[model samples]
Target: MPEYGPLHGETVIFTGTLKSLEVFDLVRQYGGVPVSIPLIQVNEVEEPTDEKRMKTCSDFDWLIFTSQNAVKAFQSKMERFAISVNEIPCKIAAVGTRTAAALEKIGFTVEFIPTVFSADVFVKQFKPTDGELNVLFLKGSLAGSIIREELPFQVVEWTVYETGAKRDSINSLVDLLKSRRDCSVLFASPSAVRVFSEDAVPSVGWSGYTIGAIGHVTERALLEAGATVDVKPEIYTLKELVETLSNRKDEFR
Candidate 1:
């Protein structure tokens, strides 16, 4: 057998979508088993009915995306409507580095990013259009109201996706975790933490497990849920969280 890593015999419950297999591979590389039980699911709407028309058809001046899901949803919607990239008339702004990179991956250039990667900072840095301020916001159903409340401009929202509880194989997952000596959960978003905590029954030995939240928002949710968070990554990404857990093996142990 090969040598075991510091995380040998450990297990990690991943609560995010499998957008990529990076999280699973990282956990295994660190000698921890990865158990995926995504607490939230995002489904892109096949069409934008409320927004009614393509953003290029409106007098939209700016397009904003907060998460990679929002960016991917926008791209998927645009493609559905046959709206080509060259046809987009407005500039794009993204909240986080990953969001910006996602936009670039779809051949859309990001024009603005705040100094910090939070909705508050992005809202404060947002510049409004001169007249009517027709800005387009690509949003998820469960998205926070900060963008709507803080916008100085008139916002046209295209809710391209809906995010909700995604629970399956919960009993089996609980059994799997119960067998592990050092089990930790990884939470990428606040909603993920909320859904998992609220749905988890009291019979489950939640107290025995450790939690890892990706950012302050998720950390707040974990705190509110009364879950003992073992690790929280400063960078607020899945890869960073896995790497941080690998480095600080004692924390989870």
Candidate 2:
């Protein structure tokens, strides 16, 4: 028989959209049975002003992306406007490793990534040159004001995408929680935590499951929602979250 990993037959439930199979594979590699209960959907914002901004993207000194969704939306807009990668002359900043990898995959060079994956750390650690810099933050509608409010540089935020709860997944998730209390549930964003809290918690309650959050922000959301965060990765990535959860399998067991 093949050797099972630490998770060994544990059900790992993801409460957000699958960005890629990386997290799922990681969970499976650790002997966890990964399950997807997508509770959020992200869609690019299509507006005339957005196109205008993309057209003059080179006007900014820096382009900042705080999430992979922003990178995806930015890439879609770039293709829509026939804007080539070489046409964008501004330096790029990504908040996390996955976000940086996404930007790099699109042939764009990422000039800055903070020591940590959070915006609060990003503002503190990201040291740009001493000058008047016009920075454009490409973000989602649900993004917080940290980048805009904290950064010392002249920052203009463009909402490139919007996040909404996937109402259809509520029933499915509630059903899973109702049936299986041993599952380790992972939340990637505050949006997903909110959806699970508002829609699923009232029905099934989240006490029995092993709650996992990807980052501090999401962990705060879970705490605010009155759910105890059982597993949280210090690195704030889905793969890390899974590995962290797997490492704590004994605690949950």
- Candidate that would win on TM-score: 2
Local lDDT at 96 for model 2: 95
Off by over 4 Å in 2: 1-3, 250-253
Q: Give the per-residue lDDT of model 2 (tens digit) for 129-212.
A: 758899999989988898899888899999999999898988887887778746888999999988888888989776887899
In candidate 2, which residue pairs clash?
none
Q: The CA-based lDDT of model 1 is what?
A: 0.77
Please give the RMSD to the true structure for each candidate, in Å: 2.6, 1.5
Rate residue 235 of model 1 by lDDT. 73
State residue 28's C-alpha deviation in candidate 1, in Å: 2.4
Question: All candidates' lDDT scores?
Answer: 0.77, 0.88
Q: What are the per-residue Cα lDDT tens digits for candidate 1 across 1-253? A: 1148866877888887867787888888888888888878898866536344664534677888888898887777777767787788678889888889999998888999876677877899877445666778888888888888888887767677889887774566667666767877788888877777766634464587767888777787778777777788777678888988887884545
